[model samples]
Target: MIRMFIRDEAGFVVSAELVLIATILILGLIVGLSSIQHAIVSELNDIGVATGNSNQSYWYTGFSSEKDFANGGFSAYTRGSAGNDTQDDCDNDQCDISCDVPVNEGPKSL
Candidate 1:
């Protein structure tokens, strides 16, 4: 039985074909995933830009009123202000996929 199995080549071709097909599928999957990652990063960058561009500043005028009633007087006051400047740290910059490391020279002798 061992000798017969060793000489058996019936499934050899099928195994080789499976390996080739699996390799191709894995390569394709890697390429597809890389593309998806890029697309998602770009979209997120766009969203960040949009959010940064939006201004949340607001202002409302203040009011003061005084009413006198038979015995006492009532007074009301309100203050308004504006804030929230549109300052985006990204500055509408797109997402960079590459690593940008600064090269340092070797240590200098004292």
Candidate 2:
């Protein structure tokens, strides 16, 4: 029976065809997946570059700061504040500094 089956050769042809088809399919899938991944990475990189190069700075409009409020709790050093401003000092960044600069004392929340 084994010798007869081996002599047939039809099954071998079918198996070879299946192997070829499977290889083609796998190769196609790999190429497609690679392309998709590359495209996504490129898009993400573009987004990152755009985000990084974006101008997230706020224009210097003006500010409303009281030199004295809540006792004399002020120092001569404060980030994004007057040289003599305390942590409690008024700053446009009461919310977020990204959309805040120069201090627009009008509307607080945007």
Candidate 3:
């Protein structure tokens, strides 16, 4: 019985198959998660752009009214200034260093 148990190969193939399936699953999960990360970043950047493009300027005119023999009421005008959105200097497309040299190039006389 001991020898037969030791020689049994029936479960060996199942174990190998399980390992292969798990490896494949893990690899696919990694790829899927990377894609999700990229999509989320893209969406967030779009939201930032949309927010930057929104206009908040507004204005309202004054009003006044008079009665038979008296001054009734009056309101002053109001306005808000608006400005164009400037390009971000540190945006993703321009944030990377253009040169191959390291930022902290060790002392020249090292």
Who wins the TM-score comparison? 1
Q: Global CA lDDT of candidate 3, please? A: 0.67
Off by over 4 Å in 3: 1-14, 68-110
Task: Give per-model TM-scores.
Answer: 0.63, 0.42, 0.49
Output the worst ten-in-a-row residue range by lDDT, candidate 1.
Answer: 88-97
Query: Which of 1 and 3 is the better model by TM-score?
Result: 1
lDDT of 3 by residue, 1-110 (tens): 99999888775455788999999999999999999999998897777666655654555454444343355443443444555555566543444445676687577783
lDDT at 75, model 2: 43
Among residues 3 or more apart in sequence or in different chains, the pairs in candidate 3 whose N, CA or C atoms overlap within 3 Å are none
At residue 74, what lDDT does model 3 achieve?
A: 37
CA lDDT, every prediction? Answer: 0.79, 0.61, 0.67
Q: Model 2 over residues 26-103: C-alpha lDDT tens digits?
A: 999999999999999779666755555544544333434455687754444333422332233223323222453585
Stretches of candidate 1 off by over 4 Å are 1-14, 68-74, 84-86, 94-110
Would you list the rank order by lDDT, best first? Answer: 1, 3, 2
What is the full ranking by TM-score, best candidate first?
1, 3, 2
Query: What's the lDDT for residue 19 in model 1?
Result: 92
Question: Residue by residue across 1-110, what tens digits does model 1's lDDT show?
Answer: 99999899776465788999999999999999999999998898888778867777877788767687675665877887767676665656644557878999998998
